[model samples]
Target: MKDTSTGASSGEAVREGPDTFKRTALLALGALGIVYGDIGTSPLYALRECFTGPHGIAPTPQNVLGVLSLIFWTLLIIVSVKYLIFVMRADNRGEGGILALMALAMQRQRGQSTPVARPVLITLGIFGAALLYGDGLITPAITVLSAVEGLSVATPVFEPFIVPITLAILTVLFVVQRHGTARIGSLFGPVMCVWFFTLAALGVKELVHNPAVLSALSPVHGVMLLVHNGWHGFLVLGGVFLVVTGCEALYADMGHFGWKPIRWAWFSVVLPSLMLNYLGQGALLLRDASAARNPFYLLAPSWMLYPLVALSAVAGVIASQALISGAFSLTRQAMQLGYSPRMEVVHTSAEEMGQIYLPGINWALMVGVFTLVVTFRSSSALASAYGIAVSTTMVITSIMAYVVARERWGVSRALAIPVAGLFLTVELSLFSANAMKLADGGWFPLLLAVVIFTLMTTWKRGRAILAAKLRASSIPLKELLGSFGDHPPLRVSGTAIFMTGNAEGTPPALLHNLKHNKVLHEQVVLLTILSEDVPHVPGAERVVVEPLEQGFVRVVATYGFMENPSIPDVLKRCREKGLQFQLMGTSFFLGRETLIPTKRPGMAVWREALFSWMSRNARSATAYFRIPPNRVVELGSQVEL
Candidate 1:
């Protein structure tokens, strides 16, 4: 059975039915709202940047055909073949992306025994996760700057205000995110869908004007460019990286939409239109490369120009919105998987699944984007920072896919290695090419990622160090239970469930409870929530209870990284299992610790203070976990680092 709430399978089997089909189509369209928003809008700026930017260098006639050919084949190989035909099939129990694929592959390797436990697999997964953060930060800045600069294209009078105007626009966009995209998403798919078709229509008219542009489709042109132009051809790889910017979203949002709907949207809708539009732009540019300064808008007729500008602007906003939302989802996934600090997540709709907002991710991106807009005012300036992050991500994804192909799907050795090698070669070239831009504004995102990565690594290590310190000299639970003997119970009556982060390990607050009260509550439930990357689990797989005499009951609630566990709802299910519990006085105990600064080798004291400050102001567990305020108890602890 498949679940409607989260749209994930209820069993280990990857199940999809009539209803799943319907919602997946709807949400995939929703995901399409997000997925195609960035790359779909890329046609707006890609050609302009390719010609006007320093490396693009005015695009000579000899290179123009080859450039067009590279764009064509790049999209064909990366998006058409790799993503649509191949990578999407590697979904894990209807879930997708590098992490989901890794989880599935790891699980399969250890099936009926133990799962794979290789360090390289885990590290590759982390690298993919890291690249996403870098990509997310750059997407908003570049997208918004590209659109806002269209003002200058309309009238040079708007140039002076571009930065301030762009910053203000982005600030407003980030501010409005809490209201949820679900309500506004109705416009997203239709606008982007229309945007592509309209561009396609325009492209068709232009291509009909000059049929020679279609010859650029051959790879020979791209290869010839490499032979003739020397390594300068590699510079276009950075721009080509922009062409498939939203490809990751295709796989990441797969859980919301099944492979079929996405594939349908990609081929029948997105692909044809994008190709026609790119070819049309190429044709237009072939006539006058200077027109490449604005191929997308130039393709439009004079009468339709303003409307095209307006539509393009709206689509640009939507494109950024989709990537912004994707960042939120990925952050939540990261937190659930133990790599990020706990952040507040708000559910956007009652019926719709995976509609969420993370305050921390929301603000971080807003600030980062605004700063980028101020620093690098043009799309081309910000473009240097764009493709490196995404290409690195794609390369990491290809590596993860290789592991999955062999270990999980039982794919043949002959097929898997070569296919992986082909993508790796292509992606490696693109990544290296983009990497060459680090001297330009490319350091912006990389610097941001390194800061984030440091925080993530520090938090992880600090946690491990604390855990090891606590574990090394801690009293055994079995011995302690025997000694304590549930000592003089009678605190709260029925099922006072305490949510603990540590499951098999000793929970710090539990010791505090033992030391202070010296008495246990009746039917004490020590609950721990576990989140896995592969979305959703069956009800039968939900509860893992080990009942102890004298009022102790340990409960574990498992959730998908994409899903949030509602405590009240989980408790209701427990009640249905005949573990009757009262809601009003059930009392949810939560732990809140303040990290004190330490002279750790990882980060400077200022960064440590920033993390501590962030921890202090973070949303409380009562609000975050959706616990009733009056019924919640928070225990605070001081940390050395």
Candidate 2:
């Protein structure tokens, strides 16, 4: 039986079971491509960095087994247990991400025992989301660089071309984003399927010669490595942490392919492939420690090297695509949630709501990726800058998950604390390990996060302050209508829709029209658009229309944070509720604010200037709302803050 509430099926073979199974199998394949790309590509550089990186230890048998043990258990505990089993349960409706989790946790739950304030959780969530942008920038740079670096393994003659080849690949990757991934998205599954199979095949080939390396599966060897190597072994964690760098994508992309598909992909394909591959690399090290320089490439025969390089480059592009798409999604959520200024959002796929492209974000990421490649020049140098942002984000996710469990899920503090504590303990340790690289290159993402966080917070605060100022200066709708009834103005022939931020007040554009033209439309609509803290608002509950005096009507249209509002769509919904609108006869009045930063009490002078700059550059409401540009009447106004 299918559970309508959660949209999950119980284990009974019904008439539709076969179809459901096929659909799920397809989705699981797709998940292998998009969801696992980052972590899946990590095998290229993660193990190599552990033993050969700056903090790499001597490749003793004990150290090899120990590091392999750490990789094995870390995947089980962090990716399988924590993310797949526990954290995915905290999804908002069907959507999952740090922002979605923040919204879910913000919902008021009775008898809640969590001491953290809502604002604190929100700030943390925003910062976490900001950190992902840094990840987005670095993922493309590092993954592509690592993939192209494989050419060097085949022959040192290809060394000179690695950086340029990586740059060209990444440039093509970003340039194609505008065309959409709908067509190529299908190929991702099959390609990644082959990639994973290749990984397993390579590992098994090496494992047959050195099956003894399987002894590392025990936690004892991992413990012994640390016990034996002391501080150096602890430092190796910075490299080990790279294995799970893209684990957050599992939860973040849960909305695209449900947790079930992600989990299936992980267990049935991704997890086993990764384990075998890591062990194979370890076994290769045991046989010949000299292979540590490029263990992943060296695992294959000389004949397979070029083919492997080609596959790795393709896989790297797929991995970069996931992070780029995620950054776009995160930006949209931030915009809808009032934490960001508006950006022009393009719908890439008509059939899929989630497939969107943001040009501003795309170009910004492209530039950031280019800068990193040009500056760092090598994947190993770039690797030092990675892990830190993602690890910090993981720590924040754990904290938010704790609050979500205590409040949203109504789990007792007793149960919630220890589970959250376990993840936190592991994550914090990884974070500290990555922190040691701050002077080396880890500071890049942290600095980037701070800049993004500042912009988000400033935009949010600035909008709130702007609304307050407008509200204080505005006239109430009821009072305005009463005066209009007392002395009616010259009535025009068509409908005039005045968009307002405050639902209860007369819009500034409406007042401006009255003052200048001294006329009113035959019908006037005071329309207010609001964003709810959910992924989707039902169509039946999308619009609310109220008839007011003097041919005036009040309409409130609500959309979810994951949605882009459309004025024409809202009008059509209003028509369903007995309110009529004509395409050519309707006019939209929007207030165009000219912000003047002053020595105000609301914010620092620098922040005010930044907010003003953002506001000035933000996409216009006419474009953002998909309104008819020809029908828009923009009224200019100045506001000092």
Candidate 3:
């Protein structure tokens, strides 16, 4: 089956998007709106961070030239070469990113015996996903703080309000997310396009002064920065790498825009301009030291700084939009995979697969990000909170990529080991640099990630344990039929389907059917829907049937967290199997088992009350599955957990 797992599978859908080159070009440009927002807006504060950050280096010509050169080449090697050119190519039928890539590797790794060399790929994927929680908190805080702090550039009078203004901007950003990005999405590409051109213009202007600054393309300069300054220079890598912070977004967003557009945008516009801007900053600094405060802002006319800041704040909002939407998508995908508990998902668009909403995830991120903004409250503070998560995630992606290459594609020893080893070098370096920031507000994001990772792990474990316990106690229908073989089957009026937790079980309604009505329908249907991590199973895998003597056994499916299986459609699949199709009076069987308080206790009273509360308001299977209201039956049983 084709996997919607990662960047490695993006080929199918992206190629399928448009056959004509012109149409494809338009689609690619259109995609730049949301896809490239993160990297595109780095001009807002990229150069400023390098100069003003904690460091001993003077903002003199040599230092300025050196720092800007480092920024330029880093963007080239890290973003352009690593992700845009190389990683984005690994799409799974137009799906892209670390998760999709790992999903592809996992399908190929199924049932393989563990070996010393081949650790599990899912573990790597989980590690990467865990790191993203850190990325999420810092992304919003840094993006907003950087923009709001620019007000100080307009006038120092705005300095006192920076914190409040930053908080207000973030609150507004999260609050309006319910509206979805469809309306503003059109504006994304144009704004980013303009932003890129502005960066290039700045770079080109500086290049005219001292074109030799471009010679920093030599790798030795990067080595020099690390060697001479030693630990302090390593600290700058923490800030320097911020220029490439949006690289992960390129992969995460591939599912929505397709790899074709993202690849085109990066190569044609995003990469070149970023390099130019960095070089220009370096060249300008080479000419004059005082201009080092912000070669980016200095690239523009003094009159334009406020307008530039305003434009940047708007663009930063769009950048935050990409991550916000991405978190929703990842949560939905995780839920679909049975890694998370049931969450309420709302589809935001008829035509766009990328537009999705999960109220639980949205609110949680809103709270986390807002808390971060209030606590850190400055672009510099939030910067300390950002880089480590993004860096480690890149490392994890590399590990997962190695798994895919070795196992799925069957790449030989020489190729796989070297590629994985190469990534380990760069990733370890970036990770180590970012690691030094852990105590300086970085713990906030780490703490957030730990909390989220714990919740996710607990949900997966709890559900698995509960399902296993039910399955162990379940009575198979064949054995059940044999037990009651002496008696003839009873007759009932309507068809009934049990929404069961386990694939095989004596649903409480079966006992109720025997006790109350004493008869079965002309056609009895025992149905159970299975959840899988994969999204959108093809029709062939949609249903499985096993017929017993009295009725037909039907197993229909949907997804773990995102999708609700349509009862009518499943019934249609059942009929297509030549059994029968009946919807009007078909009764859905549900077990409304109540948790009874007992002296032989397991949980605290508060916990018991919480569980009971959850049960009371928890969405019913009928509504969750879109089953009709009237034709439903619930069989209550007394139970304790």
Candidate 4:
């Protein structure tokens, strides 16, 4: 029997201690590699796009300062103030993300003295999560394309091969994902450490020559340009929005590195480096307007251009890797919470539970990424589609954050409303600027988000209806036990374990087994596994066992959304509670349902069909839960939707 009091498992790493300067500084270093990669790489294209792309303005002195000021303020306000200060405080037990925050809001709202409508809050959260998918797809495509576009600036000869080289690099990056990042992840911090220093150095070199460009730091220049340039300056916001593109990753990665590390890294290193780089680009444009065509690359001397471009490509790959890993994590969380279908989740590292590979998501993202590269071809073209998904997601997050502030933080409605209002006002304006390019490449992400939202909502609703039907037809556990007293079958020798989705009623698999076998095992165990909303649940609270009459036992095993449940492992833990288990003597029974869709009032026929297909294709419970194949038996049943 295993001891239930041992809360920490050998397979995982747990950090425990009060906050200290050393720990915070180390975590902050790790945060730079994983959390800041995407936004860090934005300098390769963000500034150039503002002065050269379709929505660009001339690189005059006033215009250059105006754009630089907007980029600086956007980063300071959106990434620093809104997310770092406000959203990070709303972590779900040390985890922060759109889904984690959503779960936190929903959990607290239910227990509030006066609650808001829960459905509206949930819908807002779901939409925000859906938009992240679009962001994930676009981040890789644009980041890589922008990095390689630097080749054209170095010389026109490398221009024709730019697309092919990018394709090859992305192909290799995605292909190596199954091997896990445990080894390479260490190198990320040091490499990014060097990269940030280079950015600051390059900017400082230019700032010394044109110290007057420092005036762009003031808000008055940004406001003057917008008012004087009219609609042209407003449209340039679509490009300025790119500077803070990867801010979401910082929040999403809070679970891996605590908020303090991420906050420290941003303020200490990332913010300073980015400000210097943007100001340098502006200074370059003031002296030579032609440099606006590729101001970031132009900041480097001819001798350093090649090395800098090489460094940027590596940074781009690291950024893409972080986003890809995030996609896998989000998908797993969605599945556990019943917002997505079950898929094969492969744990790539024995030491790290968070390192996982999903074949389905891997290939799907590749297809979308390849299509975007082929369709958009250039970084400037791809930039047209970049910000809207993130902008919309930010707006939704602020709305959800308002609820968290009022209910969870005990903030007054008067203060919370205005804070949320200010956030929305900024995000919506950015979204509106990006919306102007809808006909241009912007439609791709919006369309993709809509499709995904439909599929997720349909699957969730379908499962609810199916569970209700199953519960309605299930026999009470007391009735089943009473029937055995009246007419008991022949007693078998070994133990029988029946897996069920519901705990309060008799399992369909057990009923089918009894009907066909005409015998009962000496020991029977009915088990139900549940996935909770939190990221991790301690092992001490993992299992609940109840002994019933006639040698029957009911077991409920609970796992958190971030966990991967294993049946045999969980059953091994149950032995400490006086439940004996021998793998050779135990027989496991599982039910497999075949759905037949009809024109049901619960769902449209088309949606029912889609859900049925997804259900049929979902990974089997036996394989997913790591049950021994030799000891398993399957029973089939039909379900109508």
Cα lDDT of all candidates, in order?
0.73, 0.88, 0.69, 0.85
How big is the positional error of residue 228 in model 2, measured in Å on the Cα after superposition?
1.7
Instruction: Give me the runs in candidate 4 sitting further than 4 Å from their true place.
Output: 1-19, 111-116
Task: Flag regions of model 2 displaced more than 4 Å.
Answer: 1-17, 109-116
Instruction: Please tell me which predicted candidate would have the highest lDDT against the true structure.
Output: 2
Candidate 2 residue lDDT tens string, 74-165: 89989999999999998887778888888887875324535657678888999999999999999999999998898999899999999999
Q: Give the alpha carbon lDDT tens digit for every residue of 1-641 in model 4.
A: 00000112221122456646666676677778888988999998999989998899999999999998898889988999999999888888777788888888888888663544787877777778888888788888888888888888889999999889988989998898888787787778778888899999999989999999999999998898899899999999999999988877877777777677778899999999999989998998999999988888899998898888889889988888888888898888888888888888998776667778888988899989988998899889999988888888888888888888988888998899888888888889898989987988888889998888888888899899888877777889899899988899888888999998888989988888888988889999999999887888889899999999999999999988888889877888889888996779999999888888998689999999999988888888888899999999999889888
Q: Write the per-residue lDDT of candidate 1 for residues 516-560, one digit (tens) a residue.
A: 776566777778888876666777777677776557777788887
**What's the distance in Å from true for residue 350, model 1?**
1.3
Candidate 1 ranges beyond 4 A from true positions: 1-32, 109-117, 484-495, 504-507, 591-618, 636-641
lDDT, model 1, position 102: 62
Per-residue lDDT over 1-641 for candidate 3, one digit per residue giving the tens place of the 0 to 100 score: 10111122233445554455664566566656666777777766667667776533666655555676677677776776667766766665456666677666666767663663334566667667777766766677787778777677667899899888877888888877777766667677778778778778878977888889877777777677777778777777777878888888877766555667767878888878888888887777777777756557677777878887877788788778778877887776666665555566666665554566667777888888878877777777677777778888888777777676777677898977876786677768777877887888767666766766665555555455445545555667677778666886666566767777666666556767667777667666777777654445667778887776766565655543234567777877778887664687677777775754444444455545544554565557677667787988787765554
Question: In model 2, where is the ten-residue run with the lowest total lDDT?
Answer: 1-10
Clashing pairs in 4: none
Name the candidate, 1 or 4, with the larger TM-score value: 4
Q: How close is candidate 2 to the true structure, as a TM-score?
A: 0.97
Assess every candidate by TM-score. 0.90, 0.97, 0.89, 0.96
